[model samples]
Target: MSPLKSYLDLYKHLPQTNCKKCGMAACLAFAAAAMRGQKLLSACPDLAPQVREELARELGQAADPQEELTRAMAPLKARVAAVDLAAKAGQLGCTHNGKRLVLKCLGKDFTVDPDGSLASQCHVNAWLAEPMLNYVSLGQGKDPLGRWKLLRELPGGEDWHRLFGQRCEKPLQKVIDEHRDLMEWVIDIFGAQAVEEEGSAELRVVLWPLPKLPLLIRYWPPEDGMESTLNLCFDATATDNLPIESIYTLGVGLVTMLEKIALTHDT
Candidate 1:
């Protein structure tokens, strides 16, 4: 991240008051210098020397964090990057009428259990639902291809599919059904152009007698919290002719997929 961005993030979290006791006119200016390494911790007289010392210590600890992070993240990064690249290349899956059909592996086959707790069992599902939620709110006028391009660069994404696969047990359909229901709503709202036909494993498209919009499918495992999966499908055509930068702007396939589905329904 750039110094400016770092400063901005810190600034947002700061007490927005311009007390001037910090020697700077505003917290933002102080943050800017802190980010640029142009200001010293003691520069802020407003903060007690003890507080400044503590903050400085914390910042110093994080100064060389990138190297450590790189080491810890190397393996997972590669896996996610590959998937992201595939998604942008239109390889991982396809879309129709702006809706997307995602390949889902239920907990039966690959599930992620956090701390072996029941309350936490739904964490992963909730984590995956964020993009879907965003799509529901802003699907219309969205560029699905652009979104995929941006998603390719996001972190933690490289491990998403791999982690899911590892935790899964058997491919379940119930999860897919949940995901499908969510995407279907987006498709119905957006007036999509194409969709992934229910029960089909192949990535295919069509305009005439347009396939169903916002299709939902699921693979539910017999076990309770093992590894159920959700597969959400949408129209793919919305992304076919998009440009690279546009794709970047669209930012993240998961969300874009939902948006496309919603947009199709709206139209």
Candidate 2:
């Protein structure tokens, strides 16, 4: 078999579900990341058999995303060992239990041990674990400023805005556009709150995906021959509490959750 020539070549062989199962917003996003060596072909759980065969032929089988997450956790876990969870409890909006810090994550309780290992009743994903680890190890612990800003406006976010939009906002807009009651599900299930921005009546929801990292989502229904649109924003001080990458991870995770809900509704 010939070597993979480009991202499009990689994309053409994907399952094409845009399932977001590999922690990317779309299959194309996964293909792009894989092409860049930031992701693995094995990350997609639904890779077609022929695609997997081609990869094993040329690339000799790659570690899956879970294995990659486990590898990524090592350094972050080591850093947590040096942190005093008790001292950081207040700033990080967590409760310390001598060796572990307990905090609410996506409306559920998650605990971080001294070694940065995470535990919760809810099923954990790398999308959640990476951000939670960064929050514990490197977070500056700044409180939300209430003012909102695009990811591009954040200090390290300019380079990530486009990918963030593609991965988070656009997928969410599609879900909401197709399933209107998904908003009620967000409000009732995830405890998202409806918020009116300034003086406008635009439909918006505020959710705490992490304690100090709140997210704002606004959706505009289709009107006057225009397509429906959605926008996602972070608190002005968002990067103060989590790295820009972590912020992006949090949004991707949120989209994954919404997609699950939408799938459930469909079935």
Clashes of each: 72, 0
RMSD of each: 18.9, 5.7
For model 2, the run of ten residues with the poorest summed lDDT: 56-65
Q: What lDDT does the true structure give each of the candidates?
A: 0.34, 0.81
- Which one wins on TM-score? 2
Per-residue accuracy of model 2 over 134-191 as CA lDDT, tens digit each: 8888888898889999898998887677878888999999999899987887788777
Which candidate should be chosen as best, given lDDT against the real structure? 2
Candidate 1 global CA lDDT score: 0.34
In model 2, what are the clashing residue pairs, if there are any? Answer: none
Model 2, position 251, has a per-residue lDDT of 89
